[model samples]
Target: MFFSSDHPKHEFEESQQCKSRDAICYLCKNKVSLVEDESNAFYCCQGCGSNFHKDCLTVTYPKCHEHTLTFIRRKIPFPCDVCGQEFPDEMYGCLQCDFFVNRHCIYLPRVIKITRHSHRLSHVLRISDGDNVCGICRSLVDVGYGGYSCIDKTCNYVAHFHCIIRFNVWDGKDVEGEEVAASEADDVAPLLLVEDIDGESTWRHFSHDHDLLRVVEEQESEELCQACILPTYKTGKFLRCKECDFALHETCACLPRKMAHGLHVHPVTLHVETGDGFFICSVCNQYSCGLMSYKCNQKDCGFKMDVRCASFVEPFNHTALPHDPFYLGVDFNEYIYRCYGCRQRSRFTARCVQGSIDFDFKCLNLPGLIKYKCDDHPLTLYYDHRGHNSGWCEICEEIIEKGRIIYTCRHCFTTLHVDCILGKYPYLKCGHKIKVNGFEVEIASNNGASRPICQTCHRICQDKHVFNGKDQVCFCSVECIPSQACS
Candidate 1:
């Protein structure tokens, strides 16, 4: 007991790398350094040693292993220490207790301040009876990923972590983040410093009749005014009134834009207050707005119109009628009358009566009906009606056919149908010349007598004969007269 005796030593084989008497680590093949609990040896530093740290070993395993062991021991399963849930196999455990914790979960921040929300949010472990509903949008967060509620006990202002952070709930503005401008704010135009204002005027084109003007200060007016026309109380943003009531929709104030109209294939440009008093709009038949009229600027061409009316397409169809649509034409006459076909009075000036007839002939295919005779049979014009049809022969009979039928001779009152006399060429052999609108005609023959025979038909005229001085002209019927011959 009084003397300190040297510890008993053990000898190692020469092939072994151990310099001292000690056990070697099985994993690294290094010599064990120190003894633990009188039996277990420290095989390496605590990190690499077979002997685990108290906390680390207690978390991984329920009980500690015996000292001086060579093999690593298996860890036990337990609830997660951080999340209070069943721990995964890969989680670190404690040897002293049943607690186990995930590495990432241990370092997760407990409280986060988000820029989207108005209040700080804290990590919530679980829902409880004390927790209130979310303050924003009044919804309940019953389960995972909830945030810390407000300090008031009765106030159930719990918000989800996603609701607060994802939506940036701390931001003072609304979700759209639009900024509101101050009321009655003044907006000033930017000032340009010029070397010489006079030099700039030289380059400007003098297409407009008005003098060059510059803007002074912003004016507040609800009326949409034009530079050449008076102002009116119309809701529009464009309001410029320096020259005259010349206000334009901020859109129409700018000119020379290319546009298409129904009247022309080529694009046209805006023309403002340039034409003389006699200017006529191709459409609408009205005087166009001085500031908003559109015209085909082509030289020597007469097309011009208001921008609104020029947009109407040609051959326009209306639900009211089956005939071809007509547009109003400009006529400067004083008296106004309704068109026979359209039944509408002229807007600015009276339309010509000739326009009605011209429209019928050109648009309605009516002239063709007047020029061509009926296709069913050949008929000669006659005032007298004596045949089977309704027409009358002036010399003898009472009635004739409506279409084509026999008529009396002008000189002898002899009745014959087209088939009875001419055989085939009734149109050519007819002695009378046809005329438009049913005017009377005279037939003549070479020999003078009370009645004369037609040279072409070789028939004596039953109707009265007129002398043309060169020959004794005899009329069988007015229908036998040729239109050219009568003319």
Candidate 2:
């Protein structure tokens, strides 16, 4: 019953006697948005008037025995019902039966769909007969509590509860709430505007300083397109710099001028030249790939984006994550928030609030195998080590903080500093000479100067990586090789 009148015994626990208008959540214990909202604050047993966040009701076991299981807020170690192992933190317990469940073990779905397999999987009681490796995390699945297993016994697919709902696999849907739009508007803005909509074909791109001339006839060349870094198509209508050899596929030239990605509240504006040769994309953690990108224009904010990330308008979809659709938002929540993907603080993140989940752009942009030259095989982010960011970087040899996300390869025992492996200026083949405008430049290491800066971004490079060109030391990458004529 919602109120005390339904239960004849008017008995109430101390917590239930008075509902504070500033009632804190019994589970997360954090101040909820309900502190001020007029809508239903949380789940309350009318008899006691005790309040609870609705999330605490459904994400948790709905019922224990015949009654609703109460959430234990205090941190106490107790044995679990499913695995009989030590359960920590918020546990679901039954006062009458003396039963308790690990917070993670409750609300375990019976059957579910995951991107790992084509078929639906059911919760298996145990996998005792043979070797059982979780299909998602690729670790040994603990049979004590069982796990979501493939329906077909011949196909051996088992995954831990936490491994199944990775941002990459499940669609971020709030299973409890009614289906609704994630944003106020669903329509997408026009990507780019043509110079002459009357079909003149010449285009003025937002990122480029020069107007791109369209190729009308077959004029094939061995030159590669500047945007995709691929060979120019011989038969396709592409755009080329009127003077320089820089070119782009027709489709690549029309990227959106501005977009609201799921990571930040401000719109990311497209830029042809990031103006920083040494700046790495925080999302992909790679060099700018000599392509147009979107950047957060807010002062003191360093957020930048690749063409791929800028294209995914709000309500960005993955192979689809089944909790809540992540959207672009700023963290004004009045509390610290750590990202679920990179396991870093939400300094710059894409998020789904239903689970209080935040993902780094690297995860939200694409949530699957990451290809890096440092490792032979693809490296993937593991949720097991998500919150434990303790280690030392192999490249820079700096101590990685306990809360930083360190991507690892279980097979080769290869753990890497995300930045070192996917660095922006680290890919240059040192000593290689290239021409920019009219001047020749050579790739050189930063000689540890007291004050060195990139000519483009004007940010102090601190003698990091540099391009020696006629007295001007360019610390940015060759993508924007600095030159007097080009200046």
Candidate 3:
């Protein structure tokens, strides 16, 4: 219900001039009662015979307009002018103007903060023309409809009205009138520049204790990056610690201290601490040892995502699979499907909406090219062994399945299993210490005089790596890490 404010005094004067019986209320499009007293009706315009029920003229939506907006009844469904969503229910609008709003969207938050972006989004009647992709769902956002867009004009971020309001996306707060909090001082830099002598900059990364020297030269060494646990051979530029053996890929070193991910509603902070041992990423379900993770900020939530999974964004286009660009489904967790890449059933996957193809994160993020021990040249990842007969893996000595992803050398045509090349814990670096089932375990090389016997699998550790405990108990892979502590 709206009270007549001083601002609409001219409208009230117009209502008083056209006090006529048997006239239609322009606000509600309903007949003014002839039996009712003159005080019950209000005239809208003198000569137009446009009158309004005093009850209809009393209600106003201040956010949408200054004039009175009243309930409108319609038998057919109509698209809301604000959200552009079609609905069959009655709506509220100003009869004089074409502005009609859904009842549910009447009090939409003017300003909101979502987990997938850094900037606050503002509710607007219309975004720009052309293809407007939603930042969350990676679907087309209608430019004619109302949606949330970045407050910064320079940033072209936009989200659908339905996608932005989901429980997993929005925090459900309207911060329009509240005081904006100051930017976090710690978020300014991923690494602090300590000294710049003769164009060589020594920096202190937040993940490391000592100062680091940027090495632009590509390294051929097999040493793994402490941040991502990936070998250094392929990493072009990296930052090596001046004091100790800690090092990080230049890309990994520049990761922001805090970010919002689509996996959870709250912002996640970068965690470099290695005390918790191996953490299984909630998204990829892969074990990561000595690699940094992005953990949810909520106190009770146990959401932790690996760096690889955290880096993935909507509408991902793999260079190898360019024709099938995949986008994360908004309700991916609610359903499971067989993956096209690995044939494993998983809910955490991105889909090629056009092709109806799903690829799990594990198979989706496989390195395109990697060096194998037996092959002199780098092996290229193959989605399917097309144009070639299915062969056995040279490393695993197992028949390479037709549908499964594999790595093959074009020069030698040597085929290898994806797991045989990447191993069970591909992200886990050799020689790093991790905790498993309350036991301190070390990732050890399995290339000894005799392969170690895996305690969990009761077989010889066939993989290139093994997890060893202080008691000499061995595990072939991260999946074989015993639930009970080693005696």
Strongest candidate by TM-score = 3
lDDT tens per residue, model 2, 1-487: 2322223443333333445658665556765454434354455544444556655643434432455665553345776765445756556667677766666666566665542354557765455555676654445777666666676768776766665543334433322333322222233332344567567655565556666788744554455555544445543777877667667777667665554454443446666653433235655554544556668756777877666455555455543254456655343432345666556554455555454556665555442344455678756544332346556666677876654445566677566556555443433434545555556777666655365677777776543356667766564655556565665
Per-residue lDDT of candidate 3, residues 1-487 (tens digit): 2223222332333343544655787655777665545566454533233465766544566765667665554567788887788755446676677677776677688898876677889989888875588877677888888888998888888988877655357868887876654322237668889999999999998877799998865546777788767776666878888888888888888888787766666778888766656788887788787468898877898988888887787768864467767776554345466777778877677777776667888887788888887879989887652424558998768887766677888889898888878887788777778876666679887778998788877998888789887667788877677655444
List candidate 1 segments past 4 Å from native: 1-231, 242-245, 254-256, 310-342, 345-487
In candidate 1, what are the lDDT values of residues 309-396, reduced to their tens digit?
4433334332212243443333333325443322335432111222232121111111111111213332322321122344454323
State in Å the error of residue 262, model 3: 4.1
User: How many clashes show up per model?
Assistant: 70, 21, 2
Residue 95 accuracy (lDDT) in model 2: 62
List the candidates' TM-scores in order. 0.21, 0.36, 0.75
Give Cα distance to truth, residue 243, candidate 1, Å: 5.9
Candidate 1: worst-modelled 10 consecutive residues by lDDT: 362-371
The lDDT for every candidate, in the order shown, is 0.35, 0.55, 0.73
lDDT of 3: 0.73
